[model samples]
Target: MNFVYEKMMGGKKGLTGFLILATLILVIFPLFLDIFRLNLVGKYLTYAFPAVSLVLLWGYGGILSLGQGVFFGLGGYGMAMFLKLEASSVENTKIQSTPGIPDFMDWNQLTSLPWFWEPFNSLTLTILAILILPAAFAYIIGAAMFKRRVGGVYFAIITQVIAVILTILIVGQQGYTGGINGITDLRTLNGWDITTDSAKYIFYFINVALLLGVILLSRLILTSKFGSLLLAIRDKEDRVRFSGYDVSNFKIFIFCFSALISSIGGAMFTLQVGFMSPSFVGIVPSIEMVIFAAVGGRMSLIGAVYGTLLINFGKTAFSESFPELWLFLMGGLFISVVMFFPNGLAGLWDDYGHYITDRFSKSKKTKEDSPEIVEKKSDESAA
Candidate 1:
């Protein structure tokens, strides 16, 4: 029990923070917000998946990937393909020249489903693809770069370039990828209509549950020996490499793990948003994801979720009101966070929260001791 508490929960303080966050999303938000707002929060939480992944990858492992959207888009597209196929049944798509293919494919004059898309006909295959494909792709990328000892700004630039390239590829391959519009008109999942409010509520709960599970899993990893090694590699790669450890392998594993997490977010995003698009697969969204982690404090997994929620909420509110100025505001917010609060909200809490608590504690102690001290002094004078 002690071992589990220490290792899995990060002791008392970690457990307290986790419970507070869980209560906020699970109890507070659901109770206060309406369905539409709650659903929007669910969408924001989907983005949190990648944010949390960044906490592990960039924060701990020191592997900064600016191309997480690639994994995200892949996962979303995998699910979208299945849903689109299900929605594009022969009976439903009979009006199209190519019946049973995606609408975009028919419009593009593709007579048959692509070979790569055939497996998505089955839900099992789709799920497997969402789970495995991103990690596999990450493995290829990680091994190529890390094994070659390529990192730092070069790696970051390479990831950004990959994001750009993928966005272009998806946009260019209109027939295969649904083009710039992306895979749209996603209607159902395994014959269950996902357009209803009930469905949104259900998906929201499921997403929250999965997100909490991911956080716990990540916390477990960070508390383990392997996590310690990741930090060592991040701080002193040469020394760790010289100590007989294969540093590249650790980076590769974490990179793949982060990709897997981001892909889960992508899949959930498709379900919630009812579509996938190249807009989400491009450089801007990828950078926004990193900003979510940065604003929340990269070292703190739970903080990542809050950071995602805060930034997205601000985006929605600011965009709704200011519209034209939101982008500039967002840019300024990021600048401020980077310049003054580099450690993020979590860091601020760590730095000042204790002082507040300590002040209160001292005051309380002084109040309790006043009566006793006065009584002791009076007794001595009387004697």
Candidate 2:
């Protein structure tokens, strides 16, 4: 069960050498790169975090969860709750002012509080809830669906439909979810001085660290037996069951893990951006997240992150230069990637590895063939 893929010419080639080389490049780039670019990259990294989950659950586990945005929304709203409370109309208020509550809550004649939203006013409680809420929902849904052997487009369709329903429900419930306008224009976070550039960079660095941590954690899982079971269930659910594995359990586990990761990403996103709204966790953004993984390379976790970062880079670039062409430009970019590169940007690494190997081989052969000539020339030069 070695991971080595057999070489075309002879024995297997090692994956370790490639990984080490990649690690060196990653470590060095940040040291020399511009801080502004790193900050921009930091923003994209949070988005990529959820895309990593998309790769694992959709790319490997065969679960096309269109509701990943909901988990993200949970985290964003969680942080927003704390930020809103910190931005309360009155200072040191004993009665926690409800945050993220639509202004219509007063219009709807809500004189008192909703029991469910009470914990949101507490920073500690909100953060914990942000992590838990999405995970619990995903676990329930995954348990129900996978146990029944649901797979393919049906699962995808159901998830998408659920996303649409949730978005509409949030919109309709103007009292709680902030309706259409969505929560915006927030100022403080956990009493941290968000206005300061140094403080912002601290948050940015935290996101970068988290993004790398998630990738490493994903690699560990993907190289484990659990990952193998996930792929097996993805490719052939019935076969996995026939092999005596509880396929449902594996699917639920991955689904929940995806939710948890997505929640963290969502929370950090709001924590940094200082706002949350129904539109963010809505259907379109959810679909965009899926595209990020698909275009990046469904099977590669790093591809997902790189794809997201590159896309966001293009967005910033395009939006700044030719604002009118932004939509068409982005669309064309996705179309090009989809049509031309099935393995996405990660294929560049594979191509470069082969190129380097070929060049090294040719150089070694030249040295072997011309050893006498080389040595004679060297001696002559020395003399």
TM-score of each: 0.92, 0.81
Q: Flag regions of model 1 displaced more than 4 Å.
A: 352-383
Which residue ranges in model 2 land beyond 4 Å of their true spot? 1-39, 92-109, 354-383
Q: Local distance difference test, per candidate? A: 0.92, 0.75
lDDT of 2 by residue, 257-307 (tens): 999999999888886776778877878878989988988888878778778
Worst 10 residues of 2 by lDDT: 5-14
Compared with the true structure, model 2 gives a TM-score of 0.81
**Which candidate has the highest lDDT of all?**
1
- Candidate 1 TM-score, true structure as reference: 0.92
